[model samples]
Target chain A: MAVIGVALVRLRDLFGVVMLSGLFTLTAASLYVVMDAVDVAFTEAAVGAGIATVLMLETLALTTGREKVTRRRSLAPFLMVVVTGAVLIYGTLDMPRYGDPGAPIHQHVAPRYIEESGREVGVPNIVTSVLASYRGYDTLGEVTVIFTATAGVLALIGRSRRTRRRKGSQTTGGDQDAR
Target chain B: MRGNIILRVASKLLIPCILLFALYVQFHGDFGPGGGFQAGVIFGSAFILYALIVNIESARRAVPAVVSRVALALGLLLYAGVGVAGMFLGGRYLNYSVLAEVPTTGQHLGITLIELGVGITVAAAMITVFYVFAGEER
Candidate 1:
């Protein structure tokens, strides 16, 4: 994954970058499976490795595949990234170890959910019960957010009757649709 | 792409399986590690594969823009309606215990319905976003 990240940063070809990123996501999904998080792995595999790659490729088709060369060498952004990484790493120092049984989360409401969810929800998969039932409001919020995002995309680029009239004319591009 | 017999035949074989697996994920989420979100993406990708292999116009014809647009709203309405239904059933918003004679049964029914709603919305959203992006041209 680290090697892929380096390659992604170095590769000027957007197509190769997209492919490598897909590979990286696939690797992450496999790792999630190894960690016994099959639900997350399924999502990463479907969304990250599958649809995201297709979407990026479609975006590439609309734009240029080769990234433009920039001669400017400003180190401020790089320094900022390094500083932010350091701060994030420092933040993780206080976090519990991976899968720690005595972690705060394990001692919190999770215990009640695990112990009582079967009786309360009668679902074999605790994750589903929690997501669809216990966290119903959160899921609703998430759906609303997705709906809003799709609406924004529709408003911006969705084909309208006015735009339909100008179909097959590549020179007009997307700007004419704003009118 | 038009003349690639291998691509054409292979996709025809795989698309149905992809769609079937998506439905399995959607309905089998309770006993498995899949759910509406994953199922929805997988479902959308099947049509997306069809679009990528064939053409956008044919894909649009297969799933018209108006249909998807309505589905996008309908799914959300279904979810929200479920919540409102709970309120009307002498329970709090999104409370499923009162949805049926048996509390667990109600929970089960509510979960299934809400998951279905989520799956529909997500699938429509994915398809709509793709249609919009793929509609663009240089």
Candidate 2:
């Protein structure tokens, strides 16, 4: 991961950067799997590695692959990153070790969810039961957020597909109404 | 992309499998480590594969942008609608016990419906975003 991060920083080509970011996502997904968060791993793999890579490639196709040079090398931003990284690392020092059962995180309602969710939610998968039934509102909000973003995307590229359909409606995919 | 016969054949073989796996993940989430969000992304990626391998035109025919747009709203509404339905059934917002005669059965039905809703929206939203981004030109 560190190697990929370093290489990503060194590479000036935007295409390489996008590919490296996909690798970075895969690395994070693998770490999630190792931590036994398979659902999270699956999401990261699908969204991060799958969709994100394709989206970035499309962006690359729209723009030049070569990154333009910055006017100056500012030490301020570098120092800021270093300080933030140091602070974050310092904060992690107080965290419990991986999979520590007695940790503060696992002491909350997780135990109750494990014990009682079967009867209440009536699902074998505790995660799904808790997520969809116990915490259904949060998921609803998330879906709304996704819908909003897609709306934004539609707004941005609304005209191009419509205009292009006039010339060769049969050949193009835009004429959905014709069928 | 359409010019490549190999790509065409390969995508044809793989797309159904990916879509089937996504359905498995969506419905089987109750018994295993899968759910709407992950299943949705996998499903969206199948269409994305079709878009990349073939022309964007055929991809649109497979799933028209208008349909994608409708799906975007439909899935979310279905989720929120379930909550509203619960309210009408005499439960508080998002309370599923009152959804049916048997509380456990109601809970089961509610989870399944909401998960289906989540899966639909996520898949539609992701695919629509991809189509817009890929089709647009600067």
Candidate 3:
């Protein structure tokens, strides 16, 4: 995965960069499976590795495959990235160790969910019970967010106009930049 | 891509299985490690694969853009409607205890319906995103 990330940064071809990022997501999905978060793995594999890659490839088809070379180097963006990375790494130092039973998370409402979810929701998978029932309002919010995304996309560049103007001369020469 | 017989045949064979697995994940979520979100993405990707292998026009014809647009709203409505139904039945918003004769049964029914709603909306949203991206002609 680290190698893929390095390759992604080194490759100037937008196509190769997209493929490498997809590979990175696939690797992360496998890591999630190894950590016993199969539900997360499923989502990462399907959304991150699958649909995102395809959408990015389609975007690439509409633009140039090669990234433009910038004559001037920008140090501010690089410094900002390094500083953010450092801060994130420093922040994780205070986090509880992975799967620590005495962690604050385990001492909270998680115990009740783990113990009583089966009786309360009557489902074998506690994750599903929690997501669909216990956190039903959250899921509803998530669904609304997705709906909003679709609406935004539709408003921006959805239905094609070419379908309606079928009889026009086909020499418009790519002026369909809806914006 | 149309000239690549291997890619064409393999995708034809794989797409159905992907769709079937998506349905399995949706219905069997309560017993396994999958659910509406994962199932929806998987389902959307099946159609996306078809679009990638064939062409965007035919894929749109197979599943019209209007259908997905409507589904996008319908899914959210289904989820919110369930919540309203709970309120009407004398429970708090999104509370499933009053959805049926028994609390646990109500919970089960509520979860399944809401999950279905999530799946439908998610699948529609993904397909819509793909269509919007691919519809732009170069």
Candidate 4:
């Protein structure tokens, strides 16, 4: 499945690439849902399927359809992947079973959020209370990140109209001289 | 594109429901697994759908670029203002218990205001992102 996904991403067609990316996001969201992380799944669906796919399609619109050939060797990426995979495997050796009742995560600060957050925050959604209230500074930083990205997008793609206007004025000058 | 009946009809029916659901999720998040982030995404998705079905220019006309920028800034200000309010009431930064004279329940009121701020910022940001991306096609 991974190989097929990679192949789809490598396909020359821009639409195909966007579709493949959506598929990859859906698969990741499914995994999250299966792991009982419904909130994470919801976010992955929204950001991955909804926003990222649209952004990629928009990017393709601003560029040539053809994929450029890379001359760089693959050894660095390959070694990095291997090392990361090894570390992930090593870390998983001592991990608790999926949905285990005794998992440390369930026994810790998480439970406090689940149990007492409603009374303290008057919000039923513990995730929101935690994200916006308990850790509001982090959420503020996240909003800043989004704000920066919005500015960057505007800077990059928002210049086309000015260039077009300049060309239009130049053509008008030529027409005036001809008359 | 303006004459596409299918897209126009579908979006008309879907957009309202999406916005309503976004609001429901925003307020009902305490019991469920949703909050500002999820609600913002849903709200943005509705606008994105509108942009997709209708013309991008028309969508822009409906939601001007300047309005989105203001919405983004306003959300951040609302959030910071709540925290500052808390500080003035003699608590630490963002310490919700100081927001009210009542000792026990002030934290709850502060949290609600903060969540509102998050929801606003997130929704505006998401819509702005969609607008920037959708605008590229033209």
Best by DockQ: 1
lDDT of 4 by residue, B20-58 (tens): 998987777666877777887888778778887887777
Q: DockQ winner between 2 and 3, please give it.
A: 3
Clashes found in each candidate (C-alpha, N, C closer than 3 A): 0, 0, 0, 4
Clashing pairs in 2: none
The alpha-carbon deviation from the true structure for residue B72 of candidate 3, after best TM-score superposition, in angstroms, is 0.7
Residue-level lDDT tens digits of model 3 in A35-153: 99999998999899988898889889998899998879989999999999999999999999999999998998999999999888889999999899888889888998899988998
* lDDT by candidate, in order shown: 0.91, 0.88, 0.89, 0.76
lDDT, ranked from best to worst = 1, 3, 2, 4
Candidate 3: lDDT of B75?
A: 86
Candidate 1 residue pairs in backbone clash: none
Q: lDDT for model 3, on a 0 to 1 scale?
A: 0.89
Q: Runs in model 2 with CA error above 4 Å?
A: A163-179
Q: Would candidate 4 be rated incorrect, acceptable, medium or high by CAPRI criteria?
A: medium
iRMS values in order, in angstroms?
0.7, 1.2, 0.9, 2.5
RMSD of each: 2.5, 4.6, 2.4, 4.2
TM-score of chain B of 4: 0.88
Task: Provide a comma-separated list of chain B TM-scores, one per candidate.
Answer: 0.98, 0.95, 0.97, 0.88
Across A11-117, the per-residue lDDT of candidate 4 in tens digits comes to: 98778878788888888899999988888998898889887887777778767666777778779988998999999999999999977879998898888888787
Tell me, by TM-score, which candidate is best.
1
Residue B9 displacement (Å), model 3:
2.3
DockQ of every candidate? 0.90, 0.76, 0.88, 0.55
Tens-place lDDT per residue, model 1, A4-67, is 9889999999999999999999999999999999999999999999999999998999988999
lDDT of 2 by residue, B1-138 (tens): 668998899889999999999999999999998988989999999999998898788899999988988887888888888899999999988888999999988988888888888999999998888888877656
